[model samples]
Target: MFLIFPVLSYGNNITLDEMLNMIDIKNFDKKIYDLEIEKNLSKEKFYNLDSYNGVKGEADIKYDYDKDKYDTNGKLTYGDFYVNISKNKISNDIDNGDSEIICGINKNLKNIIYSKSDSELKKLDYLKMKDKFYYLDKLESKKIDLINLYEEYKNNEFETKLKSNNLSKLKTEEKILKKSYELGAIPKIDLQTLQVSRENLEIELKILDKNLKKIKDRFLYEFNIDISNKTLADIQVKQIDISKYIPNIGERYLQSLDLDRKITIENINYLSYSNKVPDISLGIERKKETHNNTNSENRIFLKVSKDLFYYDVNLENEKINLAQQNINYRKENEKNISNQLKIQENYNNFYRNYIINKNKANLESNKYEIMKKKYTLGNITYVEVMDVFEDYLKFEVEAEKAKNLFNGYIYEIMVRGEKNHE
Candidate 1:
């Protein structure tokens, strides 16, 4: 006996859990996110060197030709060469070769201090990219969609068989009705109406068959498994406790936003100290002279400078306003999370309702089987049997649709909801 829901003994079959486990990490979106994290890590290295520039080297050489004493006093003069360990360059005296070489190393103290905040921001960005839950949630959602597609295909396959059976029965009825009309016991219009009904059903069946093949092909392409002879195991719905379903605000969007807030705070702190620190450079000068005798002298010096007209004059105001902006952003995100949780509750309720629908469909299916038997035994009219069949089919289709919805909601909550379900 064929049942509405049955375990088919097919040569090949796969469970939903098994199919989900078959997810190839190579094809997963998380790999792309990992690349992004690596890129951010490289940025962190760049921020580490933001305060220092490489040594700037300079050299000069000249010939001091005394035209007045051209016969005997003309002399070759060698200029000094020095490496300045700073961003700025010192010019050499190409005209006289008397240039003093100031080979010094200096650093902007403010840049070293500001680099901390830059490094902190990059690190926060790296952490945000490294969090894998977002990609995982998306993967889970995709799996749910594939499951639903398979379930729908299975239901359509069953419906096509049922319609074929009905068409066969109608063909028999038409044969009987045509003979009755010839015998003047039935009207010609009755036979004609049955023929029209049969034609319409054939068209519908054709469309269903086309859709079945399309779905089968899609499933094979996606999972690399031919499900033509396979059936998906029923989706198991987990009982959820909404009261205990506290969403993890530290995994995906909320986590990223919070990191952004931290980065902003770091920037604001850096701005507060930016003006207090001046550009300070400490270096030594080495001078060489070749006027009459070669001589060298070394001297150490300290340089301090501040921007009289600070480029970021509004930095203090920006620091004050940025904190308020961050607070507002966090508040909006929290509100959005709250709204999503409420929608999740609605999804949970829908899944529960579908569970009841599946049970009702089973009962109606049994009733339909009994009615068909009575019609075969001549205890019920053909029309009466068809009415019961229609009701049964309605429930069956609804139950099938509900199954997909049930699975979708369960998976969504388990993977993306407040609790870590997987």
Candidate 2:
């Protein structure tokens, strides 16, 4: 995943992306999800092994001292193949002893039927891990958005401080204007205008203070971080094309369908094997005995066993129906995600335009200094100068909000596994 982090200078000179990445490393949910993926990978490896069911081996030994007889048997099995060996010996009263040996091979063909389904299920588990990782990535993106919002709140604080300072300066101007009016050096109308401007500034400052407190409280509630002393880095808007990064929702939907299909197929196989097929073992056996006369026999045998009442047709049909329902649900979910992606893309575009407009406004607001110079040169009225100041302040505050919204859109695009472009 390519993430664009525009650089900005702030206290300690840390970029927002870097800070978010660092915070993600310490996220408890991310750690837990990592562990879960590791655990699932371990399980996948275990299930892929041929001996996952278990290695089978058996040995037996017998001795009868009164008849001086000895017997031994051993067997080993792995997957569908098995080997067996047995030996026996007998001694008679004439002090003569005879020994015989037997060996044979056996194979089980039924066990291989389940291996394919088991492998598919393990693969599905790995896919689920990918989903979990994606989810965690989105969560981290959301936290980055919170950081951006906090930055906006800090901008609000900055604006509030500027307003407070302006209010102080206006108060001093109001006192001087009042003295001038009383001394008949200035018009009473000018003093009334200053008084009204001061009152409006005070009201606006109070509103800003209330909003700033609310923003701080929300930031604390969401991120558990006190931003009272924190310095937020500035944001720079960059153009990027993310269309190529958008994955096909249909393909993801197909993956989900594939999982359901594989599970259904496995279950069908299981049901068919259980209901219509009998467990069978094929082997060659050899036996030998030593007694009054030596005797030996070799035979090949096949054994079959069946459970007549084991079939559950209704249960099998129910499982098949459930699998179909899962496939349908996945298809609908894919459509929903596709729609959501479109909506998010639209939102990003809106923010991109918003940033552009705000930048333009900021450029226009720069003319406020020119207006101030005109006022000093007696080219513009005092009220005109104050109007310019108000416009500049309004634009400045709105530009901060626009940056916040734009950054939020960027984060949303990232969470959706898409690129945010201007």
TM-scores, all candidates, are 0.70, 0.60
Candidate 2 lDDT, tens digit per residue, 321-408? 7677676877777786787688567766767767776886667577877876885586765577677767777777766666666765
Q: Which candidate is the best by lDDT?
A: 2
The TM-score between candidate 1 and the true structure equals 0.70
Q: Enumerate residue pairs that collide in model 1.
A: 247-418
Candidate 1 lDDT score relative to the true structure: 0.61
RMSD of each: 8.6, 8.2
Worst 10 residues of 2 by lDDT: 1-10
Model 1 lDDT tens row, 1-422: 12322222334656665666564333436556677678767766666545343433343333335432111122221222234221111234233323233343445455555656474666566465435556655666666667677667767866787778878988998898788779986556656766776787799899999999889777666545566777666565567654444454233656556655666566666766666677676656665544445777887767798766666746666676677768877787778677767756777677776887789889988988897688557676555655676677678777776776766556555555444423
Local distance difference test values of all predictions, in order: 0.61, 0.64
**Residue 151 of model 2: what lDDT?**
65
